[model samples]
Target chain A: MLKINDLHASVEDKAILRGINLHVKPGEVHAIMGPNGSGKSTLASVVAGKEEYEVQSGEILLDGENIDELSAEERAHKGVFLSFQYPVEIPGVSVTNFMKTAINETRKAQGLKEMPANEMLKMIRQKSELLEIDRKFLSRSLNEGFSGGEKKRNEIFQMAMLEPKLAILDETDSGLDIDALRIVANGVNKLKSEDNAVIVITHYQRLLDYIVPDFVHVLYEGRIVKSGTKELAHELEAKGYDWIKEEVGV
Target chain B: MSKYTEDDLREELKTKEYEYGFYTDIESETFPVGLNEDIVRAISKKKEEPEWMTEWRLEAFRSWQEMIEPEWANVHYEKPDFQAISYYSAPNSKPKYDSLDEVDPELLATFEKLGISLDEQKKLAGVAMDVVVDSVSVATTFKKTLAEKGIIFCSISEAIQEHPELVKKYIGTVVPQKDNFYAALNSAVFSDGSFCYIPKGVRCPMELSTYFRINQAGTGQFERTLVIADEGSYVSYLEGCTAPSRDENQLHAAVVELIALDDAEIKYSTVQNWFPGDADGKGGVFNFVTKRGLCEKNAKISWTQVETGSAVTWKYPSCVLKGDNSVGEFYSIAVTNNYQQADTGTKMVHLGNNTKSTIISKGISAGKSQNSYRGLVQVSSRAENARNFSQCDSLLMGNLCGAHTFPYIEANNKTAKIEHEATTSKIGEDQIFYCNQRGIDTEKAIALIVNGFSKEVLNKLPMEFAVEAQKLLEISLEGSVG
Candidate 1:
């Protein structure tokens, strides 16, 4: 579903991702765990086509097509999604209106008409029910004074609305409590299918417990230093990243 | 990230042209360029005014000659050459129109181009429209419907001749002559505007709107709008102005006076889109307007304005709460882009006990423009328990633009409760990236954020006008970001 070859990226001439190579097929979940400032979020943002990070020497492919030149919005239209670590607050714009605009813009880019109002409302109702979001929550300003859990849940709500082909959950569990973590992980588990993929980038194995991954990779200083199955997460969580740092001869 | 920096956004902002820049082709009777007592008298005489009206203009002209233009506003412009401007210009033929069909086709086409088809407006919008072109009221629609309800809606010239008692009773009462430099000039040489009077205990059946268009070249448009709501009455009046593109700046000095009698309520809204200069700030309109309303006992007055165009704008819509328990409200959204400069806000004076006022102002500055909010809240000694709440916010796009706030409060009565809040923020690139990642482009992203910022003020507008204001906000900021 997605491929990255020698993905070297930087922001403002400060190198972040030195070299990254990854391949993920449909119907699979991949977990990329790293210490703080190890380029995990940078990978997600670069793949999402954030213009601030220049792809110094790399190529990203979606369905065998090079997407290095695509803009963030274009990537969005092509079914790429990024759950932000900290959602931007847009006051006075309701969540429903924001989703409507996002959906309509994507449809417009794909040469499709806007979804009928009734269908959009029905979808909103169904999706909010799936995520256990209150009806009134959909009418409030987009993340403007929302609690941390609400913001993460709202990000997932948007992800559900877009139904992207490749979803990158960047630090999605950073601010979630136990209950919120369960709900969010449950939502992500239900959204998984054979035709889409999810890349969960996190700093701990706590989130992996709820949404089990097919494979785990340890990112150190921008490169993947270790790759293994789900048990690798528990092992790393038990021993901490200091062992990995020693193994990498840092 | 760095590829689409603030410099790129500023460059893109310079390419946007004024949307309503097309000039209308119509022959006009233009007065020669100059300003003097003789010119002022000629304007009054040309309107066929009564003796008192003519004398009133002469007096205003005398006061104007003695007063110098004030430089206190947070704006700098090459002072306009008042003597080089033609004070009066009107369509050569002013034919009495019994129906919309009898109105001149050229004038109707002009309005149609402005998206205000009088025929459509009369049938659909249920709005009584007084269309003023280059200083003369060309067409007045729905007069019969308004007249049936004992509502007096007509051109100021017509009102002077037909309802002199009402016109004489209220004209210049709120913003009297010598109130300011521009007010004196407008009072001296004002040609024509709408005059509406809601009868006692009558609610106006429809919105009273006046659309002012400056079609002729080189002529200054000075319009005087007077609206009076009698005791126990209510009215909503709308004023919209647009000017054709010109290479040299044109002057527009207007005076608006509103009176809400005891137990009456008046809502006045203005969507001013005069010609803003080109990217290099070579031409546009100098909009200097004086708008004030007086609220009597138990009366309420509200001013809502969405100003988006003009090279230099100096306007303050104010309210004088004269009667006990009266209310005053001002909601404004001022947008400046490309070299535009706007210094606009409101003044609320509480002179009676328990008078309350609310002011909400949102200023958006893009490109190299400068937008400022200057407001004053005065609580007189007699105004016991007077309350005022004010919020002023500014949003800037690109690093070259500027936003400023100057709020003045004078509380003579210690019991007065006054609160003010203000904030300034830039349109962060992160906000844009967020929207972009959601499949919205940079342009749409900016528009979305701007609309969100202005939602509070826009909500105060009438439904139809609110939609128009939203669209105007988008158009004003289009291409303002890369």
Candidate 2:
């Protein structure tokens, strides 16, 4: 469902993703584990089409179509979603209004009519209940004055609302408590299907316990140095990233 | 003095007409373009004012001649050649309008172009309008309905004729003729604007509005509006203005004075969309207006404005808190695009003890235009326990535009608590990308963010005008963002 070939990206002339090659098929969960400066978040941002990252040379394909030249909004219309590490706080913009605009915009781009307000509200209610988010939370400004855990949960709530084809969770468990993390993982796990995929980018393997991945890739210096099964997450969690660094010889 | 014997030398001359040289052929009576003692006398004589009123006009004219144009605003334009412009241009039509059916079609057509149908304006449930076409008030709707509640709504000229005592007493009390240059100019040669008086203990049943349109070329619009809310009375007044597109800069110097007596409340709102100059800045309206309100003991006054158009706008709607426990507020969203320049804000003067004031200003600048918010908050020594809060925010659409904020706070009373906050920021690419990533396009994203930036001020607008203001903001910022 997704492919990245020799993805070389930089910001302000400083290369962040030197050479990255990865692929994921449908119905599979892939976890990328790395240290703080291993370009894990940069990889997610590049895939989401952030303008600040300069793609010196690369090709990103989603469902066999080149997406590197597409705009962020166009990519979003193609069912690409990014769960931000720090959600932006848009003041005075109600969550329901923001979500409706986003949902309708995506649907319109996909050649569908706008959803009725009542139906949208009903859908939001059902999703809120499923995600355990309070109904009043949808009326408040998006992420304004929300707690750290609430922000992460809101990110997951948005993911559920958009129902993107490829969901990239960038450190979604960083600020979440264990229970919040479990709830977030549960929400992601519920949305998984045979035609969609999930890429969980994290520094800790604790989140891997809730949403187990089919494959684990150890990223070191912007390159995927090793790949294995779910046991690789446990091995890294026990011995830390030093083992990978020693094995890769810098 | 020409050539030889039967030859004569003739020099052909052309008048430097208005840069906005559009003319509508409506039969009108106009005073010649010049200013002197006789012109003031003629204006007073034409209105058939009392002796004291004539003396007042003369005093204002003399004071105006002595004072020079103010250079304090952040606008740059040649001083208007006041002596070379006509101050009064009234339609030559008769003043006998027994009913709405007797109104002139030409005047009605002008209103039609302004999108104001007289019938629709009359049928609007809670709105009363006084239409000022050119230099005179043509018709005032809902006068009888308003009069039943002891609320007096009429033209300033009619008020001078019917309610002369009230007009003579409080006409210039709030905004004295010598208050400023434009005020003095308006005082010297002011034409007709609306006059609204809410009686004591009466809450006005409807929103009082006045529409001022300038249709004649080479004519300066000097409208003087006075709204007084008596003790315990409440009123909301709205003013909207527009002008035909012109290349010669048309001069518009208006003075609006609002007075709120003890325990009274007054809310004044304006949606000004005067013709901004062409994209090349060839011509537009030069709006130098003076609007001020005075709040007596326990009275409150609020000024809300959505300014979208004007070539060079220089105005500050202010308030004077003279009564104890009085409150003043100003909420504004001033946008300038395509060579439009505006230097506008508000001032609050706390003169009585325990007075309070709040100011929120949002300025959006685009397309090499310059927008500024200049305000002042002053607390006199007698105003103990005075409080004030001011927030001014500016959003720049491009690198070429400019946004500036200048706030001056003067506190002679040690007990006064005043706080001022301002921020200037350009719409960053990251913020835009975030919105775009959500499937919202660039234009809608810009509108959403701009709306959010001005939400604080927009919330203060009246319900009907809020939607209009939002649409205006969106249209004004078109082609602003890349």
TM-scores for all candidates: the values are: 0.99, 0.90
lDDT over C-alpha atoms for residue B265 of model 2: 99
Model 1 clash pairs are A51-B1, A52-B1
The candidate scoring highest on lDDT is 1
Interface RMSD per candidate (angstroms): 1.9, 18.4
TM-score of 1: 0.99
lDDT of 1: 0.91
Docking class of 2: acceptable
For the predicted complex of model 1, DockQ is 0.68
Model 2, span B197-291: residue lDDT tens: 99999999888888888888889999999999999999989888777887788899999999999999999999988878776777888999999
Candidate 1 chain B has its poorest 10 consecutive residues by lDDT at B1-10
Which portions of model 2 show Cα errors greater than 4 Å? A12-19, A56-58, A111-113, A242-250, B1-30, B44-54, B91-118, B480-482
> Where's the lowest-lDDT run of ten residues in candidate 2 chain B?
B4-13
Q: Per-candidate DockQ versus the true complex?
A: 0.68, 0.24
